[model samples]
Target chain A: MLLEIKNLQASVEGKQILHGINLTINEGEIHAIMGPNGSGKSTLSQVLAGRDTYEVNAGEVNFLGKDLLDMEPEERACAGLFMAFQYPVEIPGVNSTYFLKAAYNEMRKSRGLPEVDAMDFLTLVKEKMKIMELDQSLLNRAVNQGFSGGEKKKNEIFQMAVLEPKLAILDETDSGLDIDALKNVSEGVNKLKSKENGFLLITHYQRLLDYIVPDFVHVLYKGKIVRSGTKELALELEERGYDWIIQEASEKSVVA
Target chain B: MMSTTLPTESKEMHPYTERFNQLEASEWALDPSWLNQLRRAGIAHFAEKGIPSIREEEYRFTNLKPIENQTFDFCCGAPVADPGVSQVQGFCFDQLDAYRVVLVNGQFSKDLSDLSGLPEGCIVESLNEAVRNREDLVQGRLGTQVKVDQSSLAALNTAFFGDGLFIHVKKNLILEKPIQIIQLTANGDEGSNPVASHPRLLAIAESGASFSLVERCVGDRDTAYWVNSVSEFFVAPNASVEHLKVQEESLQAYHTAAIQAYLEQDARFTSHSMAVGAGISRNDIHSILDGKNSEAVLNGLYLGQKNQLVDHHTLMDHKQPNCNSHEYYHGILTDDSRGVFNGKIYVHQIAQKTDAIQNSRNLVLSDRATVNSKPQLEIFADDVRCTHGATIGQLDEDSVFYLRARGINEARARRMLIHAFASDVVDRIPYQAVKDYLENILADRFDPKD
Candidate 1:
């Protein structure tokens, strides 16, 4: 298994967000997690990325056969865990090329690889820019500063393409993208997908899954995964909506 | 407004009065009569005003009681051996191709200076030499630009200054290489009292002339020394001058400096003041737009760590019509250090169409670090545009997380953000070598420990 979480319970600021959650992902598999607003979808992604604010009350997260909960956020990235944020931050006065090069070189250094010089780094970044259809000028400008919403999302995918993590957790990457941007972003993700890596896509709508198909789907309701099924489960949720799942979870709790 | 009060009888004038009375006419190489007269006037002014107090509005944040209470021995002669020019090779902008002037213990060293191949009609000589040979040039512009009565420190420097430089850029001439002045303070033999030096510099850029000047102050090690320096610039019509002052004195030193410039019609002045040293330091810069269509740009950056205290005071006066002025200063403090930035822009009643902007931003890294920033603008003309603002803040947690999420460690991420914040002022520098040197220094000083 690329990632395994057993009985994960986490809270932020005195409020519990994830309660008794269990999930597993194998290599080359893409799992789509569909949920309504505030159903702990984004929280799960954040917890797996090792955000400090979210306190893990009781949980076990193993990545590549090692304990992932004990490591720092940067260590997790170096160990091949990538997270595409819902709202990418704007870092003024730091150019995109410099930031990306530093990130890539740091990861390489952690893995005992020879660092790439400025010339070679520039050439490599240019080749990756074509995949995201990003303008070459963006590399010279400040990181994500004054970028359109669609452009910011595209930049996130562009960064993921360059980093190439083993397990990628994308949090609501399709929230604000237009139709064309959605198609382009999906195509970029599809190109980077391979049999050696796994993906866990947390999204609210089923529109993103239509472009990049998922092998399995899960319904998350009230801080826990209520049900699990195949790809058809996403379509069912899209058509009938999340009221049924939420109602079923409430009734089950009442009966208990 | 000039007060004729004799400071000899004042209670605050005792220490300085005794020191002034001990000076002899034969001690200096300049014209004895004129020099004595100027020194007497300066001492009287200093005694009348005494030291600046925190109760005063202009000096509310900076307290100079420590310097005022301690009696420092004046370094009349070279007491320490010349450590040679190679001693300062590790300092900033040392490798740049320029006319180099070296000063050790407030005395000019000809062996360490390289003044060959200087352009014709340009003069780069010691102030002592200029005072003896070119008396007319030094007499008219020496103590005319700055008001000694307003600043007791400047008055004190004028009274007891031992040595410095005199630079003259002739009409319509442009210097291909920049002029660099390096000041090194060496400690006295094993166990002695703290020494003090007062160095004065004067530079005149004639009409249509242009040049760049870099002045650096560095010490061998952490020593208890006091340096009170002052520089005056006289820029003629259509002249352009870029002046950069880098102060990296010893951590145990007390440094205070002032730069006063007067601009003629259509003249331009740009200055960058970077202070990253001393236990306590203060830099005061005053620029006067005395003629029409002149411009001035002032940029400053200061970094303090441990118990260091850095203070900066600046004034931009728009006295004529159709002039522009802009000032930006940034400070970063860590540990128990404190920083102060006070900048003001004044527009005269006849100075219509004046454009002025002043901004002061500070970043405090530790809970104990503190910063006091005040930006003021007084505009008398109705057609002028003026704005001033100040901001004191800390590093953003979100920005730090953004870098850490990209695989950079927490320490490196914090360093990068701080560098980015400080780079805004450094990026405005037009000299490549100076910019690169400053960036390297910033990295070495602020880099995270392993």
Candidate 2:
């Protein structure tokens, strides 16, 4: 198994968000967590990325047989964890090419490998940029500064292609992208997927699931997984919408 | 308002008062009668008000007691201690295609300066030579642009200054190559007594003249020498001047310099002042947009660490209609250092349609490091577009986390952000060599062994 969360609970500013969320994913498995807005989908991604704003209250998250909550964001990243932010941060005066090269070399250094020189790194980054269909000029401009919503999402996927993380968690990567950008992003993800790695897609709609079929689709509500099934479950929910799932979960809680 | 009034206890004898008496009696080179009267007026003002005290409104944040308590030996046309040609290159005046002028201890060095192939009617000589030879050009323009009683330091410079740069571009002439002046101070040979140098530079560009000039103030460490220099520029109608000033004085030195320009109709001037050295340095970079359709751009980048204190005061005076001014100053303070920026955009009543933008951004690294930034906009005209803001903040943690999420470590991420914060001002420079030189310094400072 690549990752296992046993009764994980978290909160921010004295308000609980993710309450006892238990999940597991084996190697080469793609897990999709679909939910309504403010249903703690992004919170789970942020908490997994080691954002300290959410206080992890209890339980354990074991990634690659090591405690994930004990690691810093950089340590988790060096251990092959990457999270594509829903809203990419704009770092002015820092060019995209330099930022990606630095990140690429940093990952290499963490694995006890020699850092790639400028000539080699440029070749790798250009290849990755082509996979995402991002313009070559974007590499020279400031990172995510003055970038459109679609461009920001594409840049995040492009970075994931360069870093080649073990377990990639993409949060709302398809929220603002058009159909063309959505297909391009999905294709990039498909090209990077391997038997040795896993994927966790945190999104609201099942439209993204139609492009990249998930082995197991889980519906998260009130900070807990209310339903889990195969790709057919996603088709059923897309046709029926999330109202039925929320009603079923509430009635079951009332009966209990 | 800038207060020119002396404090109540002004009758006390001051160091400059006694030093002026000694220097005036000594034999020195004389210029025209106007310059003589100007010097006398300057000495008279200096004798009355020796040094600005901390009690004053302007000097409240800056204390000049360390500079005022002791007397600095004003080398009256004395030969300065000479250094080898290699020593000159050590100050980072390396390979650049330009006309070179060198001054040691504020005294002009003819052998060190090269002015060959200068265009006809273009006078690029030392002020010591220009005052006597081209008196017609140097007489009225020298003390006319910058007042003699602007400050006590200016007064002292006017009273005791020896030699400086004097450049005059002919009408409608455009020079492709820049004129670089490197002022080197290595006068520590005068033991016990700290030597002082008051160098004055005067540049006048006739109508439609265009040129680029670079000024560097460099010196060795471990000296308490003072550099009280004044630079005045006069840009006539339809002329343009680009000026770059780099101050890298010793850590134990006191550097007080000013660069004031007068812009005329359709004239344009830009000044980029980068201060990375000096124990206690203060600079006054003021520009008067005096004519219609004139423009001025003043930008600065200052990095200070340890106990160093760097202060800058600027004024963008829009005097006529349709003038424009743009300014950006960013400072990065580390350790227990302090930074101060007081920029004023003064628009006169008749200066209609003035478009001015000023922004001062500072990054104080340590809790002990502080910055006093204020943008004072005094607008009298109703039809003007003036946008002014000042920001003093530390490195953003969100930016750091974003980089760290990409697998970069905490230290390296912070370094990248700090470099980004500092480079925004330096990157705006138009010269590649200057930008590279400055970026290299910032890289070595923030990220060593990279």
Candidate 2, superposed: residue stretches over 4 Å from native: A239-256, B1-13, B448-450
Candidate 1 residue spans exceeding 4 A from truth: B1-13, B28-35, B76-81, B88-94
What C-alpha lDDT do the candidate models reach, one value each?
Answer: 0.86, 0.87
Tens digits of lDDT, candidate 1, B75-185: 754445678656755653745888888877666777888889998999988887887788888887888887577589888888887667888999999998888888877
Write the residue-wise lDDT of candidate 2 on B1-450 in tens digits: 123246754555566656665655664434566766778888888877867887977777888899987767787577777876667656644656788778888877778877798888688887888888988888878877678778877887888777888899999999888888888987655465888899999999999999998878888777788898988999999999999988889889999987899999999999998999999999988899999999999999998899999999999999999999999999999999999899989999999999999989999889999998988899999999999889999998888888989988888898889889878888877778888888787887788474
lDDT of 2 by residue, A119-149 (tens): 9998888788767788888889999999999
Best by DockQ: 2
Query: Interface RMSD for every prediction, one decimal?
Result: 0.8, 0.7
Q: What is the interface RMSD of candidate 1, in Å?
A: 0.8
A1-256: candidate 1 lDDT, tens digit per residue:
8999999999999899998889999999999999999889988988888888899999899999989999899999999999999989898878889999999999999999999999999888878877878877877888899999999999999999889899988899999999999999999999989999999999999999999899989988878999999889999998999999889989999999
lDDT for model 2: 0.87
Q: Which ten contiguous residues of candidate 2 chain B have the minimum total lDDT? A: B1-10
